[model samples]
Target: MSLPTLHDLHRPLGSTGLTVSPLGLGTVKLGRDQGVKYPNGFTIPDDQQALQLLAQARELGINLIDTAPAYGRSEERLGPLLRGQRHEWVIVSKVGEEFDNGQSRFDFSAAHTRLSVERSLKRLETDCIELVLVHSDGNDLHILEHEDVYATLERLKQEGKIRGFGFSGKTAAGGVKALEQGDCAMVTYNLNEQGERPVLDYAADHGKAILVKKALASGHVCLSPGVDPVRASFELLFAHPGVSSAIVGTINPVHLAHNVATVAQVLKQR
Candidate 1:
């Protein structure tokens, strides 16, 4: 039998009317190397290398590309690299957070939110982003309730600047609140951490989308001996019917292919 690719497992992104692959390609490593939590140090891939990696990902059936304004030059690089192939991928970006000089800052006021979305569109060279999440500063509930970010995202959706909007929240309550007013929530879920499982349950019950971040625990899952960490991670994620897709940030082509194959295997068994 032929090995399955992510293309074979494309599914609905909540009610946004977009179909996305089961594994999303995260571009953090493609841009920034500072303040990252990965286990080892690495150099950023040049444009040629980055393009080759993207081509490999596409050939392996990945169509969801996750980027963010806080991910260094990620959005800017993707603009030109992904030019002329805009329709081929589902792009997910974020607002409310900015990274500069190896530091991070956030702005969630209505004015900043609107400016962020417009800047993202310009950097991405696209008229509309498929999904935009508010990058939380670990103050999920506070940002959800007091900040104008979510409200502005809703306005952006109505203005046709974004297809869907949600929060990359740090708390279950915030995730639930986000879905109550938005289309999806990016939550942290993996073997080491299940604190956000409630968010997944909520999404399953409510027909909202849940995109998982740090599914491999930021590449820290391989510490256990004799355990297939990749397989283990995917099993834990796919077992939850609410998980729309897991964003895996890997720049190495071999690792990317392995992760996809493992995800394909785990989903097939499900």
Candidate 2:
């Protein structure tokens, strides 16, 4: 097959008033982490190769690219590619984790949040990003208690440093707290891992946007859920009233084309 288009993944992000594709590209492994491996065996692809894959994503009509400093060089490697195509897409990144001297870890204080955004802005080579998510891992609520992190992001919003803000955790309770208190505009992850029905309901009721991060179960559920597992995985998130889109990654043009095709079929059904 020639692969699908981005029709279904493209939709308004709740009351975001901005139309976003239901499926997006996540840029986690396009960096140094590629050097690491598992006993299961396999080698990570090269950066140049990853960049070419990103180029293909653009051709496929993928409008959103999600990444984080914790993801190693994903943001830095993205700088060159994104600089030329600034207006062609929505770029989102996280603030909780950063890399230093070839190491990656978390820092969610107010100062760290500001520093993270600044670094991301530079790495992304953009004046302002479409969205800046607080990458909480599974610790979303702890950020709320600190106050500085949320306040800083709020200030960034007012200053137009970011178009909007969101939270990325692997759980629901933390998202619920952030959604209720921090004016968090979006929450990531979906029913597969989090089964965040309550939080999604809140976001829908409140007009907040909810994004499905691991909606396809990290490709673990790629097969059992639909006719063609990959294609069906792309559509499953849209079936939920809460999910706005998902961030799928690949350093392969063929996979990018497949993503586009799957999303296109979803749009047709909708």
For residues 1-270, write the lDDT of model 2, one tens digit per residue: 555667444777766566777778887767655433322333446767766776777667678888888877788888886667788888878888766777557777788888889888998888898888787746667666764777788898889898888787656787777776543434444334545667787877787777766555555553454467666665556666766777776655766776677677776887
Error of 2 at 224 (Å): 4.9
Candidate 1: where is the Cα deviation over 4 Å? 1-3
Error of 1 at 258 (Å): 0.2
Which run of 10 residues does model 2 get worst, by summed lDDT?
A: 34-43
Instruction: Give one digit per residue, the lDDT tens place, for model 1 in 138-161.
Output: 899899889889889999999999
Model 2 Cα shift for residue 220 (angstroms): 2.0
Q: What is the alpha-carbon lDDT of model 1 when measured against the actual structure?
A: 0.93
Give the CA lDDT, 0 to 100, for residue 205 in model 2: 76
Evaluated against the true structure, the overall lDDT of model 2 is 0.71
